[model samples]
Target: MLSFVVRRVVAAFGTLLLSSVLVFLAVQSLPGDVATQVLGKDATPTAVAALRDKLHLDQPAWERYLEWVKGALHGDFGTSLVNAKPVGGEVGQYLGNSALIAVVTVLFAVTGSLVLGIIAGLYRDRWPDHLISTVSLIGMSVPEFVVATVLVLLFSIAVPVLPAVVLYGPDASVGQLLPAVWLPAASLAIVMAAYIVRMARTSVIDVMAGEYVTTARLKGLSTWRVVTRHALPGALLPTLHVIALNVAWLVGGVAVVENVFNYPGIGKLMLSSVQNRDLPVIQAIALISAVVYVCCNLAADLGAMALNPKLRTRGGRTR
Candidate 1:
């Protein structure tokens, strides 16, 4: 198990390194001049040139990438081109905001999806199964933007219970941010829930039909005991990976939902950085996102190994 974890971590770092190259190149290719953005439209070519020179934008991309990588290895992500703030500090602050919303979305989405899926699976062809399956299908079909809009309408306009968009500043405390977090979280949850529910339902069905579960039922075990003791544990293994994938997906979803709701998060910051051609900040966010993605999958793999004893052995095939 330790060797397996070590190998996965090593591979994850390799993934991060490769992703950093892609992120840097992608952001570098985005059309916009940070110097021009900093100086404004009225700035002369000479002024822009001087600013670019001062910012070392005239250097070769390879030189810049090497320098950035060197600094990143030591926890220095460089400064934001637009604001001259440390990319690490800026990202740390807003990353928390984004994480809060994503965490809230995932918690509720996972809980509700598991319950609905399990119930649906147990009921099989019954009305409960049909209703949940239908809702999940609709959810899977709808886009995140559509879901966000409907949530805004239902929660913000029709009910006027929650704020339409976050009004708090970027530096607001978590307590201050909570009231505004719900709408976006709900929007993301509604969209993310479908995949998890579908996966969970399938896993449950498969587990229920497995030898042990069938034997347990034949032994005259109560339905609750059969499900909870014999089926749920097995069912959860596949669903765990599905949940991890959804969590990784939250990064992209948060990007969209944050913009729609005007929430101050790393996603909103990244978009703004792109518009302003703030390469350092953009690269930093992208790297952080890649890290999050890699870590999610790694953690999922470890968790699966821990849950299933077979996966702990040397010959166990990794899923």
Candidate 2:
């Protein structure tokens, strides 16, 4: 297990390195000059040229990339082109806000989906199953922005129970934080819960039909015990994969939801960076997001292997 974990960690690092290069190249290829964009349209060619020189934009692309790579190795993501603030520092602030929202969203999504999915799977052709399936389909069909708007309208504008938008302050308390983040988190959770429910339902169904489930049932185990211990454990492998993939998705896909709710998160930061043509911030956020995606997937693989003895044996043989 130790060797397996070490191997995965090494591979994850390599994947992150390659992903960072790709992200850098992709951001660089976008239209417009960062220096000119920052300076303004009225800036003269000579002024733009001087600004580029100061920003090292006049250097060869390969040289610029090398410099950025070296700085990144030392935990310096360079300075934001627009604000001149450290990109790492800016990202840290946004990441904290985003992480809080993402954690709450995942918690709600996982809990709600698992309960509904298990009920639906157990009841298969019954009324509860149909009700859950219908709800899941509706949740899946609607876009997150639409959901966010509806939530804001119902809970914020009409009822005025929760605040219409998230407000961050230096002195914000934990009690105030919940109301601030709840709307956006709920919007994200609703969308993600549908996918989780569908995946869990299918996995549960597959596991319930397996021979081991029947053996457990025949051994005089209660239906609940048989389902939870014998079937649910086997079903969780696929659900775990879905959860891991969604964690990465939530980080990047929260842009629309964040924008709607006016929540401060990395997604919103990335969107603003694109609009402002802030290349450093854009590149840094994209690289961090890509690394997060790769690491989440690696962690999921390791976790699944750890949970399933069969996978551990397979991994050993492959190694």
Candidate 3:
């Protein structure tokens, strides 16, 4: 178990380190020049050259990547070329807002998915399963922007209960932001719940079909006890990894949802930075997203190992 954990941790760290390289290369490959975007197209070549030189954009890609990595290791993501502000400071503020929404989204999604999934699995081929499967399908098929639009129309326009877009500044308190976060969180939750629900339902069915569950049932154990004790523990392992992926996605992949609702999250910020060619901010967001993905996956693996003794015994290898 210790060796397995050590290996996973080392792999996670290597994944993050490699992700930083990809992020740097990706940011460097974006169309349009950072200096050109900052100084405007009317700016002369000489002016752009000076700005590039000042920002070290004139340096070789390898040299710049090394410097950026060094600064990142020191918690300095460099200054934003467009805003002329510390990338870390600006990203930190937006990250807090994103985390708030992501937390709410996960709470809603995980709770709802677990309940609905279990019900659907237990009642497979029945009305409950049909209804849930239909809803899940719609959620999976519909895009986040479409979901956000429908939500805005239903709640904001038709009902007028929740705010359509976030009205507060980036520094808004949670209290001030709560009412506004619902629409965005719901949009994300709906999308995430789809994947989680399907995975959970499948896992539950598989677990229930296993021989151990049959043995427990044959022992005359109550259906509820058999499921709760023998089935649920194993069922959750697969769903957990799915949940982790969604959680990681919520960190930086909700650009459309955030944009539709004008939410001040990492996603929206990353998009804005992309448009303005703010490489520092873009790269920072990329690195953060990658870190979240790797960490979530690692946590999920650990959780699975905890839930399944066989995994630890096998040293996390599948036969």
Task: TM-score for candidate 2, please give it.
Answer: 0.94
- Whole-structure CA lDDT of model 3: 0.90
Estimate, for each residue in 231-313, the C-alpha lDDT of model 3 and write its tens digit: 99989988999999989888655778888999888888988887787888989988988988999999999999999887787
Runs in model 3 with CA error above 4 Å? Answer: none
Candidate with maximal TM-score: 3
> What CA root-mean-square deviation does each model show from the true structure?
2.0, 2.1, 1.5
Question: 69-166, model 1: which lDDT tens digit per residue?
Answer: 99988879988877788888888899999988988998899999999999999999999999999999999999898899999999889999999888
| Predicted structure 1: lDDT | 0.88
> How big is the positional error of residue 271 in model 2, measured in Å on the Cα after superposition?
1.1
Candidate 2, residues 27-139, lDDT tens digits: the string is: 88888777778999999999899988987987898898999988887878888877888998888888877888888998999899999998989889899999999999999
Error of 2 at 295 (Å): 1.8
Top lDDT prediction, candidate number? 3
Q: How close to the true structure is residue 200 of candidate 3, measured as C-alpha lDDT?
A: 88
RMSD score of candidate 3 (Å): 1.5
What lDDT score belongs to each candidate, Candidate 1 first? Answer: 0.88, 0.85, 0.90
Q: Lowest summed lDDT over 10 consecutive residues: which window, candidate 1?
A: 310-319
